[model samples]
Target: MAQLLACFRRRGGATASAPDEAAEDQQQAAPGPVLVELFSSQGCATSPEADAVAARLAQDSTGEGAVVVLGFHVDYWDYRGWKDPFASSAWTVRQKAYVEALRLDTLFTPQVVVQGRAHCVGTEQDALAQAVRDAPRYPAPAMKVTFQRPNPTTLQASFTGSLRSRVEGPGGASVLVALYENGLVTDCGRGENKGKSLLNDHVVRRLEKVAAVREGASARKTVSGTVQFPLWDGFRATRCGLALFVQNAALQVLGVQHFDLPDNV
Candidate 1:
């Protein structure tokens, strides 16, 4: 099995998009879909626009190159009066980790991290798109995922993925997966966004680091992990799905992808 996985990883291919303003920044063809992380807050007045940018990218076609966008609502702004129910301390920790890994002085909302390589103010629409275009492409990992409802209040899913060589490096790797919901709206009671009903997309609900890739493992490392959604009953949103990110030892990311659940199964 290990030898077979290694052979498959070595056979992975790279693809180049047509050179244009959008594709100029990339060094080579991406191996998989680009992952975009939006660290935002409902308390932020400018978060709406940046949130929309994520929506646009999520609908894009991958035949060109797939893109996965996740909105991580941070908790610091909760004290502002209008607590973003979607906000999580975990998300804040994730952002802070990036600040130190990227050597930034501090953390801020409305920030977008692309492929964990490049980041910019989330509201910078043009730069966000450029960053995605400029990101080093990795192949969309070969993913297999399925969901089941064993009993009420319990949602379970099992997912597996095989990483590609373009996204791997000397440093080892880690796989992080998240559960997100779409078409969510928040009616702010107090704060800068008070009196407004805000819409958000791909709002992450749960995230977990499931596995670690060894330093000398198969370039096409394969990992299988399970994700549980405990508060599943409370969320009433369209297009609930799962997303995965594979990062290297330095916390730099290789790439990411998303898997959506069907209405019936």
Candidate 2:
């Protein structure tokens, strides 16, 4: 994991020659959505506020770039008193990856990672807004995704797209697809948030790496793959959505697109 985090540094350097104006213009014209990941927990007393903040950000679409918000419930605080039903150890590992990549001293709840480039206290709306505003934007991936319910317990997704970024370094780039649900209400019966009713939006239920963009990949690389997800008990296509993002070796997001699962599928 340390080795993986080592590859996650900011991507920048001087070019050998002048930049191409046309390419720059195209990039600006199709700036990608900003991914705002909130590492929170129902076991934490302060996380509810951050969760609310994330919900607000998810609804905001009037800006220059779209904001994609995801709520990751970490399980580290589950032992305090009441166990958070939404908490998962996998989510904790994800947050730790960011901690190592960002060189942070320790982990804490109500944390926000913006575009995998900036981190701030999740409760700090001003800081989160500033980070979003300051983060660099890339063009959205031109991908078409389709879904199918292979069985009552599974969902199959297939995607194809031309990735525009150059994938370099040992870690390469990954095509990650996240399955998320909205309009969740959890009643915390124990733990730090005991007796409080918690509302969560964009909660990531499952995250999978569908494919990898190899090192030194070309701009017109043709990539396609099918991934299967074991659906949760109360899964409803109408209440769920899929978010696909291409992340480079440095763990920086290059491009992202969201799809609303068809009700019939």
Candidate 3:
């Protein structure tokens, strides 16, 4: 893990390119959170193994500032036999964008994309392990956000974060916050698995970008905004979380953070 982290340290490109105090400050301000995204479907028999990988990574997300997992059930495979209740066309579109971004020839089930930069077969445990360890090359803006459930169905959020002027470049930056669900199970009736049941974690329910960051002319740039989400009965029994990430307009993830929802609240 240390070796992987060393590889991402700003040497020439993403890391500290200049041997100066300003460059060192930029490196220190970058938040180090890894990201793991799994493109899967209920109809794909191999997807369960990938799903398990995501769940395991999410478990570590809190411990080592490890990979923040997101399991996206795409709708393309719904026609195979049993429709994935969690599958969404929007999710499929997101996957497609990755297809272009990552330079993949096409899409496939059980594909694990790490840090939105590297990818491997989800079931390839060894490769996936290395990918997760190697994430965090792109420095994230330092950020903080809190979720408050005002009532049973509505959630209000307050966010505060600072972006380094060096990291955002001249175009500016933005952060995407998402409400995700976990420990979700679905019993497949007529798909490839027939009678099998599927359990998943880090399933995204809703996501939106905060307003464009406030790019200050000084060394310390920042942004702020408020957003809300409507909770429903479908989220009643499961564990949920809020994840926030900063990214440039080019679609590269800069930094990320995740907050698990409390049942007592």
Candidate 4:
């Protein structure tokens, strides 16, 4: 087992750039907590209950700041009933990759992957909230990420931050770049869920870990990267947005935010 470090912030606070402010205009925005990622689909009737539970968790930022919630709409359920408008193959691939990387046997919907190392049923609120509270508080990552939005579909991000190993720990970490989208809608047509309309927030469309931060004795460090949107059928690039976060190798979330969409994807 990898040794977990202490890099968590005592307080829950995040800074946003101009693009973040713009994205906030569309809907309510919050910062990172124990990042609870829900892999769900609009076509699954069981998802709404899980989604509701996740949404409530997202709202609770009091005890441990704010619980950052991200919904990754997966396309695996599309053939059952209604094809979820937000579902994407890329999102599905990301989930599968995590399974392989983490060495898991099975994967399913309404699955809540906490931080990156923990998994729980999405509808289980009590266990979920408690897990968030118990999560380790590792030191922040090596980069502080911020986004610049020239338009509604394009985003330019800057990562200038530092990561410190725990009092006596490993000297290296991985920084993940994830593009989170919010304010999504989907109509249920065929799967386990049919004839139902749905609204989603903080949904991750694409997730790619762009870099790994090597901890050093230095006081500060930095890295840079960019995420571009891909055009999909019935999915307009405008209503969608992005978020970038840097996490350690143990999958502990350190930094996160909603990236403003530039004019062009």
Q: What is the TM-score ranking, best to worst?
A: 2, 1, 3, 4
TM-score of 4: 0.70
Kindly report which residue pairs in candidate 2 clash with one another. Answer: 82-191
Q: Could you give candidate 2's per-residue lDDT for residues 139-180 as a string of tens digits?
A: 556566666777889998888766655564567799898999
For the record, the alpha-carbon RMSD of candidate 1 to the native fold, in angstroms, is: 8.8
Q: What lDDT does candidate 1 reach at residue 116?
A: 83
Q: Is candidate 3 or candidate 4 better by lDDT?
A: 3
TM-score of 3: 0.79
**Candidate 2 root-mean-square deviation in Å:** 9.4
Q: Please give, for residues 1-265, the per-residue lDDT of candidate 3 as tens digits.
A: 2222232222211112112445557466555567778899989999998888767665544434556777888999998888988888988998888899888899999998877778999989889988877766544444555556788887767676554434444565667887888778888899797888788877887777776753323335556677888776766522676667765555566666555454444
Per-residue lDDT for 146-244 in model 4, tens only? Answer: 444565554445555443332222645555555655566666566676666777877776666556666443323545555444434445445554444
Question: Highest TM-score among the candidates is held by which one?
Answer: 2
Residue 107 displacement (Å), model 1 = 1.0
Overall lDDT per candidate, in order of appearance: 0.72, 0.77, 0.69, 0.58
Query: Candidate 2: minimum summed lDDT over ten consecutive residues — where?
Result: 1-10
Q: In candidate 3, which residue ranges exceed 4 Å CA deviation? A: 1-31, 61-65, 138-141, 149-152, 164-171, 214-219, 263-265
